[model samples]
Target: MTSRFTELSVDCHDPERLAAFWCEVFDFKVIDRSEDSVEIGSWVPTVEEVRARQMPTTLVFVQVPEGKAVKNRLHLDVSPIDASTEDEVIRLLGLGATRTDVGQGPDRSWVVMADPEGNEFCVVRSLASQD
Candidate 1:
């Protein structure tokens, strides 16, 4: 059998806050919650057990210790699901992400930004727009 990806789990300091931030960024909903953990999924679970078993296919956030240090390699790139790159960039910036200057010139393609937790990601021009 072929392997199928289930979710991209992130170890964060605050699950609820990060989930909320991501919810605004991706228009995702909080499908389930607990005292120490919260799971954000694209689709809502119909039942408790379903929620427990539900794993988001695209991305998921899990709470971790406060003192954990992120190495110099953590990052995630996101593409607009339904909106144009420009629109998505505007939406993400409004959600709390701040632009970072990583030595890439202003005219260099792609918009680079950092999430609330300081993880960097890029939004590239849409494929549809390149055609």
Candidate 2:
């Protein structure tokens, strides 16, 4: 049997702040928190929803003393569900994300950005625009 993907853990200087930033990005809610870690997750899917594969992996942020010094080796690629790509970028920017360049030149389809603590992620075309 194959194992299922359930959660993604992130190391950050401030788990609360980082978790808050990601919550807005993913439209998730903080489900759990502790002294050194925070967990944010989307709505829990029902059995039918699970059968349809509607759930997404939850994100966990843990506090680390060291700051981010190098580019992220693993990053998230997210797509807008409610707005156009450009509009989503604007919204994200308004929510404390900053546009960042990571050698993904202008011709690429994705817009690279970083969260409050400089974790890199990408904004691609909305899923609705895929057709």
Candidate 3:
């Protein structure tokens, strides 16, 4: 049987703040919080809401003493639901993301950026605008 994807965990120096950054990025809300970790996901109005019906995986930020030493081998690529790629990139930059160069060169279709904690992710054209 194939395994289903559920959560993506990120190690950071500050779980709460990092989680908050990601929450704003994805319009997600905190699902769980602990001393060393915080989990964020798409908004769920009630406890009885069926998590099995959720569209995407949850993000978890775990506190660690060490900082990120190298580039992420696996990174997220996000498409704006309502904004253009350039607008979304600008918005993210305002929220503490900084542009990064991962050797994608000058002709890439996506913009690469790093979070407050230095994890790289991409902003791409939305599916509706891709046609």
Ranking by TM-score: 3, 2, 1
Model 3 over residues 9-98: C-alpha lDDT tens digits? 999999999898998999899999999999999853342343444456789899989999988999999999887888899999999999
Greater-TM-score candidate between 1 and 3: 3
TM-score attained by model 1: 0.70
Question: On residues 1-131, what C-alpha lDDT tens digit does candidate 2 reach at each position?
Answer: 33456678999989999898899888899988899999999865355665566378889999988999999999999899878888999999999999999998989888999999999999997876455
Residue range with the least summed lDDT across 10 consecutive positions in model 3: 44-53
Say which prediction, candidate 2 or candidate 3, comes out ahead on lDDT. 2
Off by over 4 Å in 2: 44-55, 129-131
Residue runs of model 3 more than 4 Å from their true location after superposition: 43-55, 128-131
Note the residue pairs that clash in candidate 1: none
lDDT value, candidate 3, whole model = 0.87
- Report every candidate's CA lDDT: 0.73, 0.88, 0.87
- Candidate 2 residue 101 Cα shift, in angstroms, is 0.7
